[model samples]
Target: MAANRIRVAKDKAELVKSLVASKDTTGPFQTYVEVMVFAAALGVKNKKRVPLGETTKREPSPIPQENFASLGYDLIIKLLGINETKDINILSSREEQDEDKRTQIFEEYANAGLEILQNELRGSVDYSERILLFLSLERDGYPSEKQEFDLRSFL
Candidate 1:
């Protein structure tokens, strides 16, 4: 299973590299990878599962916990090129385990990808333009329900 996961990770890395190389930052492929990275990081930090339809006792924050269960942290780490043992250990350490801190660290990782995407799209386009394009594509074709949900929930 571990080996299979490694294979999958390698394949995903290749795909992401190609997407990055092609400079398709605002496209579905880049968005999917970014969302997966964020969702997975949330899963890693959130140990307990809050019951559905119940408001979490935790303070209000941006990233929704409800979506974390669908993505595994290990996979996210691989996709984001995070140094598994070093990065995960640092983030998960008891001394640094506060929810806010975890969220910050996760955001840093997630935002790095977003920054890359933005840089790729810079000069050529603006966020609103990309969003409009995405909206049009969503309207024209059957979008992946999970991707759409993640994109909406994250934003």
Candidate 2:
């Protein structure tokens, strides 16, 4: 069995946009983008910092949890390069698991997400909507073309 966790699902753009919307900041998208970039670097540095990148200049707020998750998933998928391989292993890094297992996990997660979107998150407010957006990574568990791109406008 695969591990189940609340992860992101939708396209990167949609998720980012949703996060921006949830944020109390009214500055601009660039601020959030910078913050997110620094946050990813912080994750790599293996330590926490109030400002992710100070040399860059203005010190923005710390990256939020969802931002980390988004960056992490992107790193995982890219590092794993599941696209080049026929499939992936949920435990590939640990025990050399196969792609089929990973693919199955992704499919199940995507399906579950679709169910949730239809039933629970179809018309939620901005805050609840952001939570649902982050949970979309699970819908995006495995790397592949987005199955929800066309729905972007609606989101």
Candidate 3:
């Protein structure tokens, strides 16, 4: 028997386009926009698939990894409303070898990503409308099983 499927928004592109066109450049929304743009730019570096239980070796991204870092930094600036010069100086001065600082930065970015997903649910008429964004990503085979589970739990 076929597994039951959940319904999603009818026009995912249109919804995203409307969101991008909106004037609300609030921290959370801006972060959301940045993430959407970033995700669009991301591409799998390899075409081969591994067996279910095996891990594929990490490959260099199609775009330079530094591009993602720059995008992340831009999101941080928008999300925090920080002055670009001061923030860049502060970020550049950080010890790249410091584990704690690295962890903190990762956490901050994770939080911003989560905020974007959460924001979709908040203003939607129904869960399906917002969840379509995620479903579309999943349909494209973006999320791993664990990530999909976590996202479902969040929903």
**In terms of lDDT, which candidate is strongest?**
1
Cand. 2 Cα-lDDT: 0.36
| lDDT (Cα, tens digit) per residue for candidate 1, span 17-100 | 333323554434333334536333433443222212221222222334333434444434333333433454444435534333
Return the candidate ranking by TM-score, descending. 1, 2, 3
TM-score on alpha carbons, each prediction: 0.32, 0.25, 0.24
Residue 142 error for model 3, in Å? 33
Tens digits of lDDT, candidate 2, 5-81:
21222322233343343355332234354324422332333222222111111222322334435555534322333
Off by over 4 Å in 3: 1-33, 36-65, 69-89, 97-103, 112-116, 119-155
C-alpha RMSD of candidate 2: 16.2
Candidate 1: residue 87 lDDT (0-100): 55
Ranking 1 against 3 by lDDT, winner: 1
lDDT string, candidate 3, 81-125, tens digits: 233123433344344433223323333333333334445556665
Deviation (Å) of 90 in candidate 1: 6.6
Alpha carbon lDDT at 19, candidate 2: 34
Which pairs clash (backbone N, Cα, C closer than 3 Å) in model 2? 7-137, 7-138, 8-136, 8-137, 8-138, 9-136, 9-137, 87-99, 88-98, 88-99
Question: Which pairs clash in model 3?
Answer: none
